[model samples]
Target: MPPRMSDAVTGPAWASPAGKPPLSSRMMRATWRGLPAKRYEVGWEPGLVVPAGDGSPLITDHYFPRAEGDFPTLLVRSPYGRGLPWSPQYGLLFAEQGFHVVLQSCRGTGGSGGVFDLWRNEAADGRATVAWLRRQPWFTGTLGTVGPSYLGYVQWALALDPPPELKAMVVQVGLHDPYALFHAEGALRLENVLAVGLGMTYQHQGMAPFLRATLRLQRRLREATTARPLRGAYAAALGGELPWLDDVMTHPDAEDPYWRGASTAKAAERLRVPTALITGWHDALADQTFEQYERLCRADCDTALLVGPWTHTSALQQGWPEVFAESLAWLRAHLHADTSGLRPTKVRVHTGGEDAWRDLPDWPPALTGTSWYPAPDGHLTRQASTDSAPLASFRYDPADPTPSLGGPLLSRTAGPRDNGTLEARDDVLTFTGPPLTEAVDVLGPVSARLTVSTDTGYADVFTRLCDVDEQGRSVNVCDGLGRIRATGHASSQVTVAMSATAHRFAAGHRIRWQISGGAHPRYARHPGTGDPRVDAITFTPVHITLHTDSTLILPSGPPLT
Candidate 1:
């Protein structure tokens, strides 16, 4: 639904770009230092019980400007300890901007009731909370939602069939379909899954014994990554709280009915609010974030996007001030029907190598496709080799799988980092192109096609795009992985749709690509028996061969002229 002028301003008396400025044009880090403290005195109302659709009460903390008389509400639904968001940087900051802020802990976390089950319980709880807000005297009947990651997921859950009071939203680094994005092609993201699953386990539980429990859960997660029968590894540590974890282990495939019900995609066309979609290049959910942004834009909603160089956590911390400023500006213009000086650049992305932000007409630009084929000398060239069935072979042993290198990740190691150590492994094969005489600006979608044969009926193919610097250091840019099941064919062709990115490769840098059997603990290694992470005894070495015609598709796009 597109923004309708009649819808925003009625109940509460009715409501509501050019490209954004270059990141370098700003005072740089000075903007972070010089920002004034929140302007209003903050007041908090705690342990407010808001009844849900099931008549269960959810615990909430309401923060408001001390001198306010009925202001717009900024609602943030999160599982992260409810108290953590009541600080100056979160709820209070928004309250100071002439908005009433409510930070509510999702069901089963913090003071709320029920067992927290990831995406399963959000939609009903979110709708109930919004209904509760409508009854509050301080609520001006106009609302906006904000948060990142799981918090952002709540906004998605709520916005699917948002109440008319919902006027705007700011969501960062989250997904519409968890299964589709998290377990792409049925290859589970092991590192991200454990890190987040365990992190969520510890985020809100209280002190003393609970803290002790948190520590135990963390240790169990670390051990589970290396342990066999990964399914029930967390049961002993979590006790009753292990159901959600078990559900994650059992449902490794996408399109599972369990994940379909939790998605916000069903509400895609109904998201009529003015929304700001934010993400980082190195964030693991970059693919989903952009996909959702495009979905909203295509639905004709008033939407904007901002991409940064930060990771999932950094998007909230190091980038909070900017996120705050932009979010406040956006909500004020929408929820209040006040559009003063609001020129929203529809798409804003930060170019990594160039270290500058640009406002684009749209994502995946007006770019042309460029294909590179695998050559005999291990060179990624424009010409395909006709060397008569020439191939590259590697042994993929599940016991000692090729490790995941740095890239768009959510685990222990993320962001832009050197992959020199990773490239040296014998199990990994790399193809490189000659140095570019001039800068090569690449943006949008990237993909890989691999024609290979596996000795067994099942295997996984991991492909990564990299930039090799003039000094011979190769750093991961984007990656793609897919699980393949043999259909009794001699050799099968598999295509992996990679993550999206906007990067400028400087002159003297070479384009590189790496292929391996798996990105371990980040992605579960395939067990030759066809089922993965089920047991230890099924592990076997699979002989894998890549035919000469495999290609890399890069969005080399039209010139910037």
Candidate 2:
């Protein structure tokens, strides 16, 4: 008996006024109808289960349509509640599509009965959940997982073990590495941390205990006007055994234990199942996704990476429809269904400024060329010319640190929008290139080479790559910051890594590089002292120098004529 399409499948709610139905919902329904009809006779039954794990009892909300036959299952394990509108929508969509959807609440949050420990129980619990699903009568012995962010994290974790029943996974904006994505360049990304924490608080509601504790400490510090008492209270509340925070403060350098737990680079290589890796250029986790894609490619795993011109939230609000459609197509192809029109072994990137998409065989087209070096007198030339004068110097003060006007700072409302405001500060030095002869598309890694000297042993170097319009308004294309300790500096040239961007510098648009000492609160201000954490509010005037031979390298392609 083939499953009959329900009225809900044909209603306006499922299909838009346009001829095409909503991708997300329609795909789910289509998957259901595509399954063998005999399974439809067996209805689904709901249940909950606690996996055998160390942390807490897992709570799984099952949606098996009471039918007569076994059906393939779709699993979504989330820190967010299983009953949330989004979760149910996904479950219902999958169930209607022909697979039993199981939505589970992670340990300690939602309806689960255990203490939540971020990444601690994800692997073990995921395995246990899969094993449980395999035993259920409604299960057809195959399982797939899909989700974004935290949910995506679970998929990656489960894939590490190569679960027997796990067939495929769709991971979106998942945190591949926490260290690089969060505490970047040895600075506390306060804004993004707070935004994620607050959002989790609202979703889980179980974070009330931690919130109460944090609030209590905040009130105590506020009342203590004196620096000594405030410092004491703040240390007690935020310092010491706090694993996550301590990891950031202690390991100012990138590759630490804390960072290892957050990143899935190693796990990605070990994964064997087919995977769909999705991310956005505007996502803070874009670097992570790109890194994972590269790793998977090197490992010779079956994987597809999709990058769009969207932010973290935009992917879910608007991008998921397209994402889901492509995901289903991928699944159908691998599942021996259909893949007639899909393109293979190619990269599709959104060309900024032009606001159009282009397809290429490789990430950065081989046809692209680089400008040798720009001369000091604002000339774009191929020949290398040295500055007769000494290096350029700037004074960096910790107290009056340069504030981050806009960039990647995370906020409840929205992250940093544009870098236009930060370009106006005096502390930031700008070097501009003449208008391009034609449109240049830069789509990969950006690097800055600098021979620099700082009066203080410990200082941070920030570089921003931007585009200056004819009106002289500078817009930040991409930026990267590097923290240099006194011990790491010796008269040698150093390179700082900045965020990646995909932008086209118009023929008349000048390419500009803005260098500064700090982006403040978005990043913890470098006290310019040797100590990692400073208690006293001291302002140090550091003499910073950038040599004449320095260069900003852009991964650009041949001019689009």
Candidate 3:
């Protein structure tokens, strides 16, 4: 056994201001809490240009603790510009707690020179950066990395072939494949992908108007939704061409060879390190985070998972003070092999409907496969429907598709939001369940099995799970989309795998499964003419018919009486 780290490394020795618990606690270690906002003096070293494997100069920012003596180094690589990472209580605060922090701009962003390619160029660049850090006399022999989203992606890319100096990593809201970020079930993620692309364009172009245009999408989303055919609107938003966006528009298939170069699934196969992961229930990458955590644990790696009720950006803010101190504990225990602030391997998730957190030995909590039958007239029941059960039919016109609503959307209003407005659309078909007499705990992955016939061979399937209270307020739980390559007059089975979630439908609350032909701009309308969305400027209306074979299968914990 290793010696316990001194109290100084524990952080409670440093008295925090009144009204707060100890600066750090063991509970925070098990659960992810953002590090506290305590004061500490740190020296900043900006614009430390380093060479990549290809000899391109990568711009980096390094921060050092004032009282440090050859402190361990932490590296963060990003394409979201280096400025925000160095802001107060973020990058600088990491240094304040005794470590040299390095925030680098990947190739083509910030001061780094090269064309900005979305997933490409990260692995080689990350490897070169870590190698350079090891040779620096100012950096101690140990090195760890931290960052979120794109920053998190870079860490997985490096773990594919980590250097000996790389000891620990902290990845938040990351993906194993680029497809999870832009494409799902052969459908383009319209609004979210465009925002990311436009934001990237703004960063590269650095134009005030372009930046404003990106922000406008969020501010006047309803107005922005008016832009037609998607391709033209996204291009217009940037006021110019964005190669990354162009690639996504052209390569619509998630399994295409084009994405092979950047898929983190390849790296996940070789991952071997002490890793800490944090995610949010409503986050777009929540499912992927859980999948990655499961993979790591199966490999016998030291991994911890934390899922809270937060959006992509607000994930760390869920419990900021406790998280900050917990983050420090993660770094100390992993890098120095210290046991003082040790944390166990477990899964901690936030139950949305219940609005509480659960610590379990593993995720997917021994869920039973429960199937809810779709009653076209409106009801979800466990008892199989009779042949006399009426079939629900709604005409799906591409010209007027159902609009986007709250779900795991990245760029728009994400998290749990009222869906009453969206449910009123004529193009959407709703199947409701009777008000439950007892609370039902719905946990883990959800999938829908549908039997449907369409007038046209091509169509789209959009499904949503919502909780409707007695007051008549409907809020989104989880949703997913599946594209029908071709359909016929005969009923065909189509399956849509909704994202995973941990929610409890309280007593008196009704469950809903919304069936729609399209979610409009968020997912491109199936032109109904058999052409792809890129050429979907003009589309023909197709009538869609849904039959009784459709079922919403939810993974639930204990069977309800």
Candidate 4:
């Protein structure tokens, strides 16, 4: 079934007298523990029509507190329709909090009239909505933008040519680079691509259709993911041809003309808006949020960041309380000149193993780089080996590719999960460190430099950082993938940049570094024949060798002497 908006929280609270605020509005405010609502009654104007740049009708909904007073206006543009989650989460909830909220559907979605063309139409359509906003007598002349996922993309689109009324932005589990979303390290991210197709094609159509589509995708996932010549493989699951998905899968190069202007990183570089970013440790776009935070800092834009222990969808569902509080505080600070609720620090992150929140002046506080080398005997040690003897080996078959478990996926299976079964696979290599006598804190970026050789010149290296407990349950922390194209029988040195994290390897726990050829579905399996994975017709098994000189680099809090 399609996940419902009310699944996050429940309330039996009654609405205000005269049924002014509505049951949904009262339930939401009571459900998510956040700032107190400023008003008990909310006025809603549904199905407001606004004109797009090309004269198409953009459907919108307006929400405002009924009490007398001008309030800051927030513009939310979404491709996922203006119902359910969007209506209750953004439209009604924020309205009760004293902000005039404008919730509009993107061109061609919801009731909007036009052809949806992905990122192409957002900017012009956003500006057109703002143009429509300026004409409203109750617009207040001050504006902010707030939303999660693709809704965040539209904010970046508008910031490319920001209107004068724009002041603040809250991007929750946001996306700015479409190319990176589809491909990672030159390989297609097959499952995520199909998930996106399912969302865009069926989600906005409403509950029943979305539930059917989700079930169809689940039933046909394996067939679609393993199909030969995969360009049109997702048609069965997605219900029809999605030309855009086919186009993105075929164009693997980010620099190609097909994706020339896809990234909105430039918007961050030039934006002077006070932006607040919210993401989960396992969010699929957590890396993108980090990149955005860094760029905003370098540009000297007033910014704040909040990282939690959740996933892409959970950042809005399970993590909604913290997410909403942080967003409301930032918006109130910038748009309403109210800073009482703001935190003292600019960055706040949740430490995983310790399960505590840490506030810092900046992300990735200065930390010492610790190197752990992999030994031939399946051990992880600080000491480097002088002789490269006892080379570790494995065989990866594309016909039976390595399965992806958890961590940073867009589905329900995302986030931290036990990796005991995954590590037992013959195709995977693991190096374990001795149980720690003292707690070790890891607070920043994680990377791996490996010396590897494969029988086939074309291959991919999937490296992951895991924490194994006393009972021997291995759970993933962060991981990354890199493709290697080398000459026959020659060793290749490659660096895999894993996702950054703020975690604690508790006392009595061991650290493990895992290496494999690929993580299927999360990333399309390499053909091992130097051919594009989408177009490759032949599958080959590869024998991979790992040398002792490889090391895992971590940003550690204290020296582990």
Error of 4 at 450 (Å): 1.0
User: What is the C-alpha lDDT profile of model 1 across 1-561, one tens digit per residue?
Assistant: 112323233222211001211223222323455344544544566678988788777888776655524567888888866644324455656765567788888888887888787887788899899888878766778888888888888888888778888888888777667675457687777777665665577667634444576667666655666667666665565543466666766787666776667677756575788888889888888888888877887888888888888787777767776666667778878876667635555787888777888888777687776888877667888887675264787888888888887777775377878988988887888999999888887888889988888778578899999999999999888888976677543678899988888888888998898998998877877876666564545687887788888989898843343
* Cα lDDT, all candidates: 0.74, 0.62, 0.72, 0.87
> For each candidate, C-alpha RMSD in Å?
7.0, 6.8, 5.9, 5.3
Least lDDT summed over 10 consecutive residues: which range in candidate 4? 10-19
Maximum-lDDT candidate: 4
Q: Model 1: number of clashes?
A: 9
TM-score for each predicted model, relative to the true structure: 0.89, 0.81, 0.89, 0.94
What would the per-residue lDDT of candidate 2 be over residues 115-221, giving only the tens digit for each residue?
A: 66667678888888877766765566778887887787788878777777777777877775656655776675644544454444446653455457556444543
Name the TM-score of candidate 3.
0.89
Candidate 1's TM-score: 0.89
Estimate the TM-score for candidate 2.
Answer: 0.81
lDDT of 3 by residue, 334-434 (tens): 87555576555377777878788777778777878788888746777777766523377777787777777767767547778888787787778888889
Candidate 4: tens digits of C-alpha lDDT, residues 311-420: 99998887888998899889889988889989999999999998899999999878888999998679999998786543799999999999999989889888898998
Model 2 weakest lDDT span, ten residues long: 12-21
Candidate 2 CA-lDDT value? 0.62
In candidate 2, stretches whose alpha carbon ends up further than 4 angstroms from where it belongs are 1-47, 63-71, 83-85, 206-262, 340-346, 367-383, 387-389, 405-418, 487-492, 534-539, 559-561
Residue 311 lDDT (model 1): 81
lDDT of 1 at 284: 86
